[model samples]
Target: MPEALERTVYVVGPRWHHHAAHADYAVAASLACQLSAQVKKLNSPIEYRWLSRALVRRLLTQSKGEPNYSLGTLLTEIVVARHMWRRGGSLYHLLYGERDRTLARSLPRLFTRPVIATFHSPPARLAHKGIDRRRLRGLEAVLVVAASQRRYFEEQGVTRVFVTMHGVDTQFFHPAPAPAAGPPRCIVVGGHLRDFETLGHTIRLIRERVRGLRTVILGAPTRWQQSLYSAGGGSVEFRYGISDHQLLAAYQASSLALLPYQDATASNALLESMACGLPVVTSDVGGVPEYTGSDGAILCPPRDPEVMAQAAVRVLDDPAYARERRVRGRTRSLQFDFSVAARQLLDVYATVLGDAGMASG
Candidate 1:
């Protein structure tokens, strides 16, 4: 029997920077780091290497204003691909596919190694940002956070498309020891694709119906603070740059997770909230229903403050219903643990490597 060639997979993506001390957050921003960590524990033949952060920063700075399809971006990708070629890797995975679409499609021609990419944006977001189908056809595989996004890639003629559900750190975000005794409070976290206008309106309506209803908005941009505060009818509290312990504490103390989104794929806020045993009421847009399903959350139409507010009030008024939602949400979150996602990703890596080897033979 011949000795098998060793396999190396290089992970390329933006640095997982968080203000909190803990690496775990509800958003998929930490996917590269979390996924890499899980892959390491499996003790498989595949070895993973991260592209140097200094190199990434240099490339990002060069392509600051125009990150996609620009002359600078093209040069950046070429530089990165050539660097990897010289460094030597059996395969390459681009964690943020949007940043390196051109590289992903062209790598196979320039080098014999297989390339795969994971895309986080929904179809509408992708369309708005602009993606070239021709540039993406070269990928060995495409991984998406939501099932709804699979069709876009398949339509573009990419043969292998997989839906890898976003994962959360369940142990860190676990529920409180017991419900806190105080006025009902709701938490809103993260600002990406969030409908702040509708959130302000919904909070106002929620306060009118439920007395002593406190709302906390975390990670909101400083520019929008005044408007949100005024719209929240002076019952809103804003916090920023807090550590992970504080964040987990906030989730545990809150009564419900009230999130309104213009569009979404997979939300860290929703998953983190559910894992913390906080009931969720969020918008029913792209991939939101797919993650929450019928029982996991109370879904409301986008930009409809009245409907959102009504749902919030209902959860606040009925203890039994709120408890039911909390139980269902935590149960649902177990399905998205980081370990599960790591196993699925490992399988994809093995299959891609096997196919690549057969092609060469």
Candidate 2:
């Protein structure tokens, strides 16, 4: 295929796990895995592939120990570019996350192959400074995780757009059988404890509004998680470093899932929770509304503790409404089932390669 044994593609991103990073990296890795299978389906060779590093020592030097943009992520992109150039391959696809529009823009011109970028969210403040509208035009396709992001990219002139929803391993997040029980258990998974100040503040509010609620905060503890439990007036419990399956059980056991983010779009926590047949209470930020929809979740304003608290209370008070939302959420999650989304992504890759092959011929 394409006069080469192995076709190469690269993932551009920050660290692969923890907080929001987990979903983006997981999606990219899954895409790569799926692509490997499809390429074999086409009887192509298993060739070179690279993933950018997760740590940046250089950026730390410039910012005096804090990188404005992730140095590890930038280096990773650069490494991938170097690999493509060295391999002399004419086909490359870029799956981007947590970086600048301008930097991503330069990649297609530099790499001499078809580039496709999946926009994880809007550009950060630094990257926003010299953002180039031209960046969106060169890619074979600009993937938006949520329909809500489509307009923003359109404004930037990225017309060849596709809405590929985020995916979760159904095997990992399958719904549990109906429990013969009393008050439905509820929990919030993947709280961004790295940004604990905001996370803790929101949990405190949830504690106030919903009394005697068994809330489990999953992820490594930052000072904020500990402080939230200590100062939370004996309501919320903190559990650190639980395996993914255990996390899934938490979702299966819970009646509702809460995603309290200061600002985020298409969070994995929301999808995983919904996949486990749990309705959600999440902030109305980014592409979240697109995924959660009207039937699946209760939306609240960002960073407003009072509003978030009330949203959680609403779910606790109405069993019928909660059950309806959970049913809808589970149905919605199937639309993003990995098998479905992976095939779509494989189709995109096939399209890009076919076009490249035509131009070369």
lDDT of 2 at 189: 67
Q: Residues 1-361, candidate 1: write the lDDT tens digits.
A: 1123246565555423552322232234334335443222111121113455576577667656544555444445655666667854466767767766767767766776677888878888776666557767677888888988988888878888888787777878899988756999999998888999999899889989999988899998788889888876788899988878899999999999999999889777888888888999999999999878898899999999999999999999999999999999999888877666655666666677677773123
Give stretches of model 2 more than 4 Å off: 1-15, 19-79, 86-90, 99-107, 123-141, 155-159, 180-185, 191-211, 220-223, 303-307, 353-361
Q: What is the Cα-based lDDT of residue 165 in candidate 2?
A: 71
**Each candidate's lDDT (Cα)?**
0.75, 0.61
Model 2: which ten-residue window has the lowest total lDDT? Answer: 39-48
Q: Any runs in candidate 1 off by more than 4 Å, and if so which? A: 1-6, 18-65, 68-83, 87-89, 358-361
The TM-score of predicted model 1 comes to 0.82
Clash list (residue pairs), candidate 2 = 6-47, 52-76, 56-72
RMSD of each: 5.9, 6.2
For each candidate in turn, the TM-score is 0.82, 0.72
